[model samples]
Target: ADHRVSLPLAALLGAAFLPLADVAARVIDRPAETPVGILVAAAGSPFFILLARRIGRR
Candidate 1:
């Protein structure tokens, strides 16, 4: 629960997530590539909404 630990863990997870998303983008479209932002946003939006809602509740 410490910021020190959570920050680094978040960074590591983000680093890991981007590459996986990028790979998915490349593979998903075959001859073309999906924009990484689109993939990232699509994946992140729901989480962001949930986080916002949780914070709002607090």
Candidate 2:
């Protein structure tokens, strides 16, 4: 994949994902709030692991 395309796609996906994660943090705890970082890390860790593995293989 081209970096030109991949970078913009990643940026767009991040732009879309952040608000959804923020909403989830608010709703998940109901009367309270969960930290947005927790949700982001939970959602992102798998992808980061996968990327790390892919890079390691190269």
Highest TM-score scorer: 1
**Error at 3, model 1, angstroms:** 0.9
Which residue pairs in candidate 1 collide?
A: none
**Candidate 1, residue 19: CA error in Å?**
0.5
The lDDT of model 2 is 0.97
Write one digit per residue (lDDT tens) for candidate 1, span 1-58.
6999999999999999999999999999999999999999999999999999999998
Against the correct fold, how does model 2 do in TM-score? 0.89
Error of 2 at 53 (Å): 1.0
Tens-place lDDT per residue, model 2, 1-58, is: 8999999999999999999999999999999999999999999999999999999999
Query: For model 2, which pairs clash?
Result: none
Tell me the RMSD of model 2 versus the true structure. 1.0
